[model samples]
Target: AEFEIPGYLVWGALIYAIFGTALTQWIGSPLVNLDFQQQRFEADFRFNLVRVRENSEQIALLQGESAERQRLSERFGRVVGNWYMIMRRTKRLTAFTSSYAQAAVIFPYILVAPAYFANKIQLGGMMQTASAFSSVQTALSFFVSTYRTLAEWRAVVARLDGFETAIKSAAAEAISTSSIGVLSSAGRDNIHLQKLLVNLPNGTPLVSADSFTILGNQRTLVIGPSGAGKSTLFRAIAGIWPFGSGSIAIPAKATLMMLPQRPYFPVGSLYAAIVYPAEVGAFSSDRVREILIAVGLPQLASRLDEEAHWNRMLSLGEQQRLGLARAFLHQPQYLFLDEATASLDEASEAALYKLLEKRLPRTTIVSIGHRSTLEAFHQRKVVLRREGDRFVLQNQAEGVKSSSDAPLA
Candidate 1:
């Protein structure tokens, strides 16, 4: 406007800008989707590589080098394939923008020459008109030039949005009012379940515990046939499972810990890993060593200062022993062993049970095992019998009632 350029030049520039922008967006539109796929593919391939690295020993033992190479190649193939698509799309966009820029150099001359030839404007006026038109064209093509960057940024934003949405959705589902309710009951000596029905994520009822109470300071064993939702039952009491309805009223201020078949140990010093979920210095090194020795891990007694991935370095049986050591150190009010000792020999399992009985007699020990040897350790037995599609918790101490009658499922 300041240049006093011809109105026709402005009109021509506007038309050129509008068409350029449309074409740029049209050519680059797929880049957003392509970039998103590229990120996902890259992540998947990296994750597969990590998985292979973590399981390198197993792969080597199985002599699966050829199989793994093929698997990794397939994963990398997707990454390369999507990158090519992005490259092609970007090339097309670049070509169009390059031509558009070259055309813009002379576009002002074409518009102003008419006025100059008609002897209506001076040569300086023609030069000034072209300059002004070029400036406007640059401003308008700014979006076109930065379209690739914008697409990648948009793809990142989309992935972040999706990640946040998934996390929020999981949180929402976990706390949904329709799911099972876990509450702490004041002045209650026992853990109680009233009208509790544990269901799978798919809304299938797995176990029904209507009126169950686990008396304080007692050992209990839970046994059921395969696929009887044995582990799922304990998950409900831990307040981690949310697929069911009704309420589980745990004793007030009772500390509970569930030791799964595979216990997770952070990659750190043996002392830190053993007392995990507890700070490094929470338990004195001497105390952790004693606990480790008591758990029949005397071989690891002097290795408290050793830092490594205990989960990977130790065998499953060794890991289970470490898990027991953790329980002994933590001394939780209730300890649920979900086949935690299954890896150990029967004698070793018996010895651990004896140790628990002697050391933490007040702590309620709940074991889920198939061995008849477990019954000798527990005063009570809770069995899950398949009725229809789901299993119902039956207490041998009581009668054949649903989950509510039994203390632990």
Candidate 2:
């Protein structure tokens, strides 16, 4: 009778554990995908809030606060909707798991109670059988109690694996023969491009240039119709865009600086913003103040110690002026400006150009702009014309007049 009771209790615990584990798995499978999407939705909602904060000035100027608020609320709604689904699923899972645990404790006792009553076993034997049965059940039911945690772990692992794969693929392509290649040359006097083809990230051809040279001390302006891949060419030269074929050779040990339409400023003192990309205090405060005054930001000179979001607080024109001020401080060998002065008026733009010419006489300036006034500042013009599916660079020097000779018509 003792042997029979022990065998029966052991079999009962094993069957119970197997059934509970299978049920838990079936109920928890959906939670893995749900948790993955929940994380994505939450990240999206938070990113939207950050975007709204970054562009708050533009939204306020366009009186789009209500529209922005609606968009943000909708993003939050997605997060909340997904979270509710997770909660419902989790609640259902919890109910099953809790009942399974409680039932496990009582199941062993019920299986052995008949033997004790029938004089097949004493109280001690009954208690020992229940204890042995509980240990077996607990050992086998580990999955039932930890299924939710395992599902969450699986989702996290999948996300990390995807991220690592993307990073590796990008790194591989950066050195691939089919991608835009940036080669370094020993000379420090000229930038050269040999049969270079710059493409969009989707493998669509964007810009093509062949045997082009931008010499030191040259002021060149790049122009084209909208979407002609003007800014993209600059990106290719900077070795950041890696979606096309051919080689771009740059002078070795040369400093290159790119100023965009909207310059980014770190949230700190004016001195740091002006001398950015350089260590703070790299240039003396006196020098930074002089450049600020040169760029027509004398009012800012006195506020070098003030910390604020200069990009949002100051006007775009003011930001452009600061960008030029930074360039003046760095004195890079090659400077690429993509509509850097579009925010300023022609008068201010001309003055800034003059400041560059006076201060950075040896720095080669390659500018992308639509304003006719820009042509006056450049000694040469590089035009990008649509050719089949790509825009080809055509260097023009005929009738190319300096700003001092004739203003651009």
Candidate 3:
């Protein structure tokens, strides 16, 4: 009878151990998925705040602080609510697991007590039975304990998969029918656009042209109303805005640079910020110093090694000057400016244009600006005129006159 009781206890333990382990593993998968999702939500919440801070100036100028506050609050509220739900689910799982563990500890004693009372088992036998039963239960209940973790893990996978899908979709849109193709130069001295059709994000036609060219080493100014697609043209040339149909033939090995109204400055030393898109050793310290002085920023030359948030440190005028300094250093084959010098005074703007002409005599200069004073610096002017729902490029006779002899518009 004693041997029979020991055998029965061992058999029961083995049966429970196998079944318990399987159950635990099955349930634990979902909990792991849920934990992963929670982490993704936390990261997304932080990313939103960074975006808001970056656009704080625009929000402030538009008096959208309250609205933005509400929007951010709502976003954070969703994060908090979701976290709370996750925590509650975890709490329930923990509660059940703890109860099951406790019961497993006592269950073996209760089951083998009958043998003990009948003088069928010794103290050692009873202890061994209890240990085996607990091990079996532990193996079986793994899922119940880890269900929350599995769920979190699944959520994380889903979020990451969704983000990747979005990126792919964007890339596809950038390459398909909506994309603009920049072709290799065919020994063309001029930038040419053939059968170009520019469209808005919503697929609304903005500008359609059969053919156009900007001659090499010539200054061409593009003038249009606020929403007339000047900036979009620049984007198309840069190959970033793909919502256009056409081939832009650029010189195969030509260096092209675009200076936007608000230039970007990476967080670092002043010198690093000035020579960005180029390595640190691309220009010597003395060369950078000379350009800074030429742009009326000699004081900044001494602070070359000093690190700071340059965008926040310099005024708009100063930043524009720094942009010119960048152009002076890089000396690209073609330079496109989208209202790049709009922030400076007319005199300063004129001075910068003259300095550019003097320093970069061989560089093709294309500028988009509303300022009439800019006409005197350019050899040609192209105006975008509204035609039905789209704009067409019109070459004004004024464009044929040389800047040196042309009357100021």
At residue 328, give the lDDT of candidate 1.
95
How does residue 314 of candidate 1 score in lDDT?
Answer: 99
After superposition, candidate 1 runs with Cα above 4 Å error: 1-3, 397-409
Candidate 2 residue lDDT tens string, 53-93? 98887899999999998998888998899889889999989
Query: lDDT of each structure?
Result: 0.88, 0.88, 0.82
> Which regions in candidate 3 have their CA more than 4 angstroms from the true location?
1-76, 106-133, 405-409
How do all the candidates rank in terms of TM-score, highest first? Answer: 1, 2, 3
Kindly give the number of clashing pairs for every candidate.
6, 0, 32
Model 1 Cα lDDT, one tens digit per residue, 1-409: 2447767777798899999999999999999999999999999999999899889999999999999999999989999999999999999999998998999999888887878899888888888888899998888778877888999999999999999999998788778988889998984468888898999888999998879887788888899988898899899999889898999998788899999999999998988899989987898888988888888889999999999988889999999999999999999999999999999988898888888887888898888999877777787899888888878888876422222222221
- Report the candidate with higher lDDT, 1 versus 2: 2
24 Cα displacement, candidate 3 (Å)? 9.1
Model 1 / residue 249 / CA error / Å: 1.4
lDDT tens digits, residues 47-84, model 3?
A: 88998887888899999999988988977877787777
Position 319, candidate 2: lDDT:
95
Ranking by lDDT: 2, 1, 3
